[model samples]
Target: MRLSTVILPVRRWSEGGRDQWLRAESLGFHTAYTYDHLSWRSFREKTWFGAVPTLTAAAAVTSRLRLGTLVTSPNFRHPVTLAKELITLDDVSGGRVTLGIGAGGNGFDATTLGQEPWTPRERADHFGEFVPLLDRLLSEDSVSYDGTHYSAVEARNIPGCVQRPRLPFAVAATGPRGLKLAARHGQAWVTTGDPKLFEAGTPEQSLEAIAGQIGKLGAACEEIGRDVEELDKILLTGFTPDRGRPLESLDAFVDFAGRHFVLGITEIVVHAPIADSDFAADEKVFEQIATEGLAQLAG
Candidate 1:
């Protein structure tokens, strides 16, 4: 399995942030992703920068490592504007950009833009409209659309993306509607196990829950006559009950990854060590995992 890291946008680009991206590339990480948010859960009061700008800067500095948002959502983003930014980012990164997108949750991002939180059904509906329009905006030269949640009139992305039709999309979903969207539009599928199991469930239960979710995703793909194996299965670590266990050591991560690999996971994304945070871990160990963990799993 390919190993990646999520570098939270909490540090300023001048101070220690740029170093992290460089280090990730040097360590041979497949991709270095960041949280796309106005403000994330606990990092709300921290120095959270914008995801696009941070990624743009990262693209400038890194040559080999792919850059992406762990998940961008329709929360405070319009498809027209986001497509423009992503097209530019793809150009800047030399076609080394993947978009991890999802139906956003009822977090601080939900109400941050002077709007009420959307219900689950509303979020799903908005996502259905958002992903297709965004896909069109990136692929076609011009787009015009009217829909329940979003409308774009003669929106134009002239030069378009560097990545042929568009950049790859890693759709984050666990629910039926969301999984169907992923199956339809995604180059990859992402999950963080099951949220219900994050706080109280055992590791075994979390594994079972993810297996069930994968089964649903397969069914969703089958409904559309798409082969599920055509999409890469990605597990964004740290949300399952196993939490930091995988990052505890190189051996731990290999074991953790092996378990998921059996479940058809192709990519494993771990957080870049953030001292004293929910994502805190040993930096050396994380680097070891980046460099050697996947090889160990193969062996």
Candidate 2:
């Protein structure tokens, strides 16, 4: 599987954001991404640490790595305004941005921000219409269209998105309907979890289950005439391990997770130890595993 880079817990690790982002380039990660946060407003906040500016700063410093908000919910951003920001960032990244979008999920994001959340059905419907509007605004000069949730007059957006007509649009999905919706609209899917979540079986069997579910998603894409192979379906297995083990156990987990990740996603971003753990043994174990694992895999 391809190895993409990620920066996680962005909500908590705001201080080290740029320094570590610059560090990822040397670590041989293909992309640097962070989760979107719009809520949890403390008494004070800085705007630069938010998702888009973080990406912009990362883009300015790095020449090779890709950049994007791992995702930002559309509910937080109106389509036209988001399209503008994405276009500007795409220019900054020189077309390396992967614009991941979704219907709102966390109620904290909505209720706390006073941005009323949508039902699952509403999210699905909004998701369907969201991408098409993005497609229209970025590519066409005039987008005179109307949908249940949004409408746009036949007006041109000056200086549209950077990656040609259809930029890299990924859907953040977990459930069946969401997956199907991802197939129909997303150029890729972003998922996060640990590999132990799967069953005990041959790696091939595990891969088959993942591929089967993805095949269903791909079939849905086929109905819409989008090529399945072209889509970058990826698993975000943040391989969070507990303690030290022999190289054999670490190797097995890394390779096994890599196989399933390949079957499911175009890339896998290893979730390494964060170094603030209580037990030094656990830290050492996961560090040994991640270090050896990346050494072998990146090789």
Residues 143-246, model 2: lDDT tens digits: 77777877887756767767777568777775667677687667788664324534344434545556766777777777778887877866655322312222
- What lDDT does candidate 1 reach at residue 9? 92
* Candidate 1 structure lDDT: 0.94
Report lDDT (Cα) of residue 245, candidate 1: 96
What residue runs in model 1 are displaced by over 4 Å at the alpha carbon?
Answer: none
**Could you give candidate 1's per-residue lDDT for residues 1-299 as a string of tens digits?**
79999999998888999999999999999999999999988887788999999999999999999999989999999999999999999999999999999999999999988899999999999999999999999999989999998999999898999998899999999988899999999999999999999999999999899899899999999999999999999999999999999999999999999999988899999999899899899988888888889888989
The stretch of ten residues in a row with the least summed lDDT in candidate 1 is 38-47
TM-score of 2: 0.77
TM-score of each: 0.99, 0.77
Which 10 residues in a row give candidate 2 its minimum summed lDDT? 238-247
- Candidate 2 lDDT: 0.64
